[model samples]
Target: MRRGMRPLLALAVTLGASTVAHAHSVHAGLSADGRLVVSAAPAAGLTRFDPHARSPPHRLPSAGGTESTVSVLIDHAAMESGLAPSLLRAVVQQESAFNPAAVSRAGAAGLMQLMPGTARRFGVHDRFDPAQNLRGGAAYLAWLLRHFNHDTDLALAAYNAGEGSVHRHGNQIPPFAETQAYVRSVRRYEAQWIRKLRAE
Candidate 1:
């Protein structure tokens, strides 16, 4: 395997999948051969591998208290899902404060606070798993960005209040106080991330 295949292969191994295929580099299932194969972005020069079997239950990795490891995973998810690194960082910060096991009162779970339905839509079998959750959330965010024409505010509003709610309100941010606050918070965090990057 080429060095370019290392990232995908590592991801597959992390998920305990012998052969993993993702339409959008989010989750993994299995394949026929025992060797791990991953389908990543074509730009990465990774070959496509279709999995023939179901993946086993994932063994959850420790996200650790310092949050350093989670940050790396966030960067990876952002790259794979075509999301801005700052935006993903902000979303994760606002969503779960880097806590992989975090669960919301509204039933959102993991580092990105993914709802059950959203998680399933992104092929995330374990919501509390940081890697899976970040990838799933990043994929959803990327789709939202495209759906709303790369309007960060609108996409974030849709993330908080659902795309239907945004559409129902004429593609604008909804009037709900909580949703508004959520968008504001994410934006604030995003700004901070941007400043941090600039300073670096």
Candidate 2:
């Protein structure tokens, strides 16, 4: 097995046993100050209940220059989903270049560059809504992660090109130039974000 597969397999094992504590830069949950907050659940198990009700919540930073509203939502969703925020940011950067108002030639919209059909399937009525759009996009990513057995590269490729294309090619990374480039870019960004997070 490849090196990447090892980590993914470990993650699968951990996930199978129970949800692991995800290292998140931003903490989500209820605020002690009586403000609304989104918190992460315990690392040991998956709970359908909202984790935001916990305590000692941190405020989410506002979107800044070059940071679209969708990116913020994606960040929050990643934290809430127990996924890596950097990974979400990297995917968003590759998908829409952090443009919340971006529209693909193929009719994908919002920060994550979700297609109309996909957005609908994810129950996103307003693709322009940052929170809804991020939730939809992150949910889709989570689905892809599970589908690809946590293979980040393949999952990302599928996210860009479509699962059908990947499956048609024997579950291998499709040879499409755009898809390949997208994966590489996302990986690069993921690495960068991971470094940034470690630095903090």
Candidate 3:
């Protein structure tokens, strides 16, 4: 498939109404605070990765400056990583809103809000560099997808809350408010991007 069409194709595969419904049913029930209600506290010994919990969430930036350039980079990374461009866009939006200079309070940086360890693990030398950051983030997401057997919700949960947190919670989304909201927001953005791509 053409690079441009990959998002559309993934839309068909990943963005069905059933996905959202099932996610709500399986990963999170309807909590008044939108937190994941669990029968027990999350297991111990997992390093919780919740950057957004420390940093105030950023609104999507107005499109200008690096916007077009970031789109190109996202497409290139998506192509090389075999990830959906819509999903990449959604992650970038949720992470840094396309700001390559963005850094979270917890020390995550760049468009993907990669931590120092994650950047190094993904061979991302310059996390402030848009291309490298997107590449690293996409590669990590792809690996998470495989690690979680292509379960998008689990992969997304791992993205926000760490793989160990998911495993600690018995291969489920960790019972964290921020992580649950992060997964929900990213999925919402992915769906919006898919709809826009289909319209275009």
Report RMSD (Å) for each prediction in the order shown: 10.8, 14.1, 18.0
List lDDT for all candidates, in order: 0.70, 0.63, 0.70
lDDT tens digits by residue: candidate 2, 89-125: 8887777665444566677776677788999999987
After superposition of all CA atoms, the RMSD between model 3 and the true structure is 18.0
Q: What TM-score does candidate 2 get on C-alpha atoms?
A: 0.65
Residue 179 in candidate 3, Cα distance off native in Å: 0.5
| Candidate 3, residue 41: how far the Cα is off, in Å | 52
Model 3, stretches more than 4 Å misplaced?
Answer: 1-66
Structural similarity to truth (TM-score) of each candidate = 0.68, 0.65, 0.69
- By lDDT, rank the candidates, best first: 1, 3, 2
Model 2: how far residue 51 lies from native, Å: 31
Those runs of model 2 whose alpha carbons end farther than 4 Å from true positions after fitting are 1-64, 68-72
What ranges in model 1 sit over 4 Å off? 1-65
Error of 3 at 61 (Å): 7.3
Instruction: Report the alpha-carbon TM-score of model 1 versus the true structure.
Output: 0.68
The digit string of per-residue lDDT tens for model 3 on 43-121 reads 3321112212344435323322334535766888999999998998999998887665567888898789899999999
- Report the Cα lDDT for residue 38, model 3: 27
lDDT of 1: 0.70
